[model samples]
Target: MDFEQGSINISDDVLKEIAFRSFIEVLAPDEKDVKKLKKSIEIERTPDDNVIVYVRTVAPYGQSLVEFGKKIMKNISENIQRMTELQVSAVNVTITDVVEKIETTEEEE
Candidate 1:
């Protein structure tokens, strides 16, 4: 979707892309694993020009709703400055859910 005509236009694809990029940048993965982690996140635009980003993140043993929300806000702010010509009032992130970590062991060949 296009958020260029004075209204926030977004689709699932766009939200996923934004969430993936934002998460990767803020979380700083050891490697680029967009496919593995992207599906666990969701993002939406609020009516007041704020962005709502939700994620089921891993690494610190538990999810940090506050930290994640801050990251998303920063990302959205930066993006608005770099990509858009409109004035962004603010970015509000809401962590609707959390995911539990499960141990994964890789088998040696």
Candidate 2:
């Protein structure tokens, strides 16, 4: 018996954007994080054409970076696979920085 799995080709830039969005999804929803945050991903293609994604992002100060990384990695990996059908070997999240979110005060507005 023979089986065929059609291949889906996705561009690196698109993957990076998807990863960024997914990373943002797991971030602490301080309006600051949503407004002033950024993230990047590097995808290393393997011998089998599968990819390992390395994500770099910031976390809210005093937040558990380990838990943040885990959530970001899991969410990004799942979104990538579900949307693109690409095989992800692993998602490694690196917390590049932790910044405090100043509480939004109406006086500042």
Candidate 3:
């Protein structure tokens, strides 16, 4: 009896896609109707195949910046490693902007 192991190789674009999906899932889950705030993201790799992902995102104002940052890092690193089965060296998250949550102005009857 013979058994074979299969492997999957993803391109750089795939890496970017995965990183974006992961970020949006954790960070921008509520931004479905609205376009994704993350304008740019990338997955960098070392010569030895180590993975490093960078994400630039927008955050809602009046939130805990420290906690938010931690969540982004964890989500990106874990999601990528979980989905791709690759050793993620690190996940660097950058908050490019903070948009104030607009209050709904309903007219009084």
Question: Which numbered prediction scores highest in lDDT against the true structure?
Answer: 2
TM-score of each: 0.47, 0.71, 0.73
Badly placed stretches (over 4 Å) of model 2 are 1-7, 28-39, 102-109
Question: Candidate 2, residues 1-109: lDDT per residue as tens digits?
Answer: 1237664567777887787688767764566644334435677878877778886665677878788778888998998889887788999876666668523233222
For 3-109, candidate 3 gives per-residue lDDT tens digits of 27765677778777777777667665454422443346777898878799887666678988778878878887887788877788988877766668522112100
Note the Cα lDDT for every prediction shown: 0.54, 0.70, 0.68
Error of 2 at 75 (Å): 0.7
Error of 1 at 63 (Å): 12
lDDT pick, better of 2 and 3: 2
TM-score of 1: 0.47
Total backbone collisions, model 1: 0
Candidate 1, residues 2-104: lDDT per residue as tens digits? 5557666545466557556766677565453545566566555566645555655543346566776677678855765455443445555544334353221
Sort order, TM-score high to low: 3, 2, 1
For model 1, the local distance difference test gives: 0.54
Specify the poorest-scoring 10-residue window by lDDT in model 3.
100-109
Model 2 residue 64 CA deviation in Å: 1.5
